[model samples]
Target: MDSYTSAAVDGHLLTPVTRKPPLRSSADRHGPISKLGDDLLVAILIRLPNARSAFLCKSVCKRWSSLISTSAAVSFITVNRAGSTTAANNLL
Candidate 1:
């Protein structure tokens, strides 16, 4: 019994198992993912539930900071709605 116990203690049978890395964070770039280009980033932001998250992405970095500030996105939205210009101007 002592020899059996010693053998088991020195063998792989007593070794602890290591866990695999978590997968969800690796696969999903859902929000504020790193290394994204500006155009693709805007596409992701548009899919968010609302404009607040879109605007918050600006603080992520300098490139993102500038991309959201441009008139292109605003133009895209305004074109979709004719009255957007007047409403946006009022907000400004």
Candidate 2:
């Protein structure tokens, strides 16, 4: 060790830095479904009772919406379903 460092340690001039781990919220305690893989999420969504149910489910959660869009979910269930117009861009 360098003389300065050794002297500093001997004199307790440098205190060790302590770091605390990030805290998890209550949602982390019981929401295990969020941990589902994308394939599983899509599969489960694709098996809904009907296209309506699938479309409704798409807005259930942000993650759910991200995993499956309303039209995508409906199309997955109804292979021959007709297409709809594109959604307009969201403006501020």
Candidate 3:
């Protein structure tokens, strides 16, 4: 049979532990969002509620800014380059 006892000091009880848990690395703490590709990032940013929200996402990092700017340009060109002149005029 094995037995152990806890020591009490100042009305608090303390127990002995065999080992402490390992500390997490900075990358592990931040998770995998940084690992997403530019295409996926652009798709996510496009789903933001409005232009202001999308612009806010741009300030998150330099990479995000580049992706957001590129996606916005592509979207603008696509909208303005349509065959229908009425659709282009209505945008203005």
- lDDT (tens digit, per residue) of candidate 3 on 5-91: 646655766666688779887557557877776655555554455556666777887767777678554574344332434533444
Candidate 1 residue-wise lDDT, 29-50, digit = tens: 4544655655555555555545
Return the top candidate by lDDT. 3
lDDT of the candidates, in the order given: 0.56, 0.56, 0.58
lDDT measured at residue 88 in model 3 versus the true structure, 0 to 100: 38
TM-score for predicted model 3 compared with the true structure? 0.45
Q: Which ten residues in a row have the lowest lDDT in candidate 3?
A: 76-85
**lDDT by residue (tens digit), candidate 2, 1-92:** 54444437655776456799887864585388877766566666555555676667767778677656655644555652233111111100
Over 4 Å off, model 3:
1-30, 71-92
**Compared to the true structure, candidate 1 yields what TM-score?**
0.42
The superposed Cα distance between candidate 3 and the true structure at residue 12, in angstroms, equals 45
Count: clashes, candidate 2: 0
By TM-score, who's the top model here? 2
